[model samples]
Target: MRPIAILSVLAGLSALTSPAASAQDRPPRPPAFASPEVTAEKKVSFRIHAPKAEKVQLSSSDLPDAGRGLDMTKSDEGVWEATVGPVVPGAYRYSFNVDGLAVIDPRNPATSEANNNTFSLVYVPGSETSDAKDVPHGAVAEVVYPSQTLQRPRRMHVYTPPGYEKGEGRFPVFYLLHGATDSDASWSTIGRAGFILDNLIAAGKARPMIVVMPAGHTGPFRFGGAGGVSFETQMAQFEQDFVKDLKPYIETNYRVIADREHRAIAGLSMGGAQTLNVAFGHLDEYGAVGVFSSGVFGITGGPNGGAPDTRWEDAHKSTLDDAELKKGLRLVWFGCGKDDFLLKTSQATVEMLKRHQIDVVSRDTVGGHTWLNWRDYLVEFAPLLFQGK
Candidate 1:
């Protein structure tokens, strides 16, 4: 090397080793590891390096006293730490509340999304149905189609079963729906629909099929809120889009069996109600209906905490009484948690249907209004679909 170049290189090396460079230029090396250290027992240890924050708390769907928040203590180095749970084996969402500000765990990359917010995800493996298993995986696609009814383009998440890209035959379609605050993306992400279906199909518990998760929130919806594009109005608009645009687009674009006997409709929470309205509105199009933790709005009775509204039943009296038309349906399934706020809603709906002589299967499990029950419902319900009985 030339003497000038050698001197310049030496000067740079000297600067890098200088005290000033070590103090200001080189950043503090990151910790050996980061937040969300999961133990074998499923207890999770979480940490955040925040020196300025006076308070930090852990908030998770599965944590004990979640509504009350789990306190996180600070260390000498200003890092906040907390450990919680033998967290149940499933996917969960968690966030750190730093002095009232909600923040996703920076150390965790896996995330679950909702219509209005996002949360960090952690998987507590060992679940038979919901966990990642040694099975053939399916493909989840996000595609958009023009909504002729709404005069706009809309998006949806479609899960084609394993080998669909290479397969040569048509498959049955399950129109899966999400909750009021969830977009079309919820099923494949937080709900883990793809993995659950893959596990089910691989284990011979379910037939391979297409699962379509559409955007159910056509407009704003807040439970117990008065006026301004109520959920009922949004449901009507969604029904129109589903029937006129979304359904036909899927049938044309994908390999779907275009018959009522090969189609099923189901959803959770807001989506469950949508399932009822859309499927019942066109009973000739769907062979099966699955309701998870939901009932007709305002028509809820018992523990739903209000005077039971029978106006909906009174309005649909003729249809409910038409047992002949509904007989064409192969299955009418309903599931709710024992502690779910909508337990009464599910019960009243099932009782009303039974009164009309409709054959309905009701399942009561242990859980509240959450995905724990929804995922379980899907695993239990998917096997019954497209069974040529």
Candidate 2:
């Protein structure tokens, strides 16, 4: 080899054998830390490491004064923290705002999502009924079935009891639903349905039954109206898809007691309206109905829902007074928060039903339109279903 070529070969060999190429070139890892350390007193403390950020805050709908963000104080090491609440027991969605950017706790893996955003989840475990306990847990399944009405496949979440696969007998079903902008997964995740049901079933408070959580947003829905697809049109379409499509699919696929007396339906917010549309209109399908924090929208005092030419009452007047519906329904349950924006609408709904000589159970709670109340409502509602059978 030529002298220059020999030198070049030696340089290549030295570079190949160098420690920098093997190990020293790797970047340093960040310091170890843990977030969301809950104190023994049940206070939730949130932490984040953002060295360059000027401001950080903790945001959560579950907080008592969430409108004013929980201000976090930064340490000399750039770790920011804020502690609040002897908070109520349930799963609450939270996000860390670092210098105006909303982000999840990087140190935490538990999370939940909304239609437009994502959030980290924290469980404050004190409640006997809502907390995930050491019990025979059920299985929650994501099911996709054909929607012949809309010409596409739709998704739903179905929760089967602990021994559903091994058991030979069938179980009654309760159809639960989510509010607007939330998907079918809401009940399983932040809503904590699985845990609640597991504990309830194990404790013999609720019967071992299947819970079906279906997506409620079937069409264009916003605060105002969509261009052509109005709320009534969308709700009507949902009613059709639900009664005609999803019910049949669930009945044929699952091991269910396939009759009205064994089936019930319930929902919150937008879902509450959907529940009314499905259960009230199709009286022969469901024996019990639960409406939480909602009623017919477009009523004058309804929550942010704009005025429609005809409210839900104007449309469902005949159906509400139907003898088959009155006779077939085992229980008509209505629960609304005292501070909920839709309290008046719920009140109107109950009053209207009562005028027609229909019996309804109206429950008034202490919170606003939120998951805190919904969780409690579910615990109370689940035990009441299929009791007459």
Candidate number achieving the greatest lDDT relative to the actual structure = 1
Cα lDDT tens digits, model 1, 229-331, are 5776788899999999999999999999999989999999889889988887788788999999998767764453768888767877777777777778889
Q: What does candidate 2 score on TM?
A: 0.89
lDDT of 2 by residue, 78-148 (tens): 88988888888778888988888989999889988664467889888888988878899999999998999
Per-prediction TM-score to the true structure, in the order listed: 0.90, 0.89
Clashes of each: 0, 0
- Find the 10 residues in a row with the least total lDDT in model 1: 219-228
Off by over 4 Å in 2: 1-28, 219-222, 225-234, 301-310
Clashing pairs in 1: none
How far residue 270's Cα lies from its native spot in candidate 1, in Å, is 0.8
Q: Candidate 1: misplaced stretches above 4 Å?
A: 1-30, 220-229, 301-307
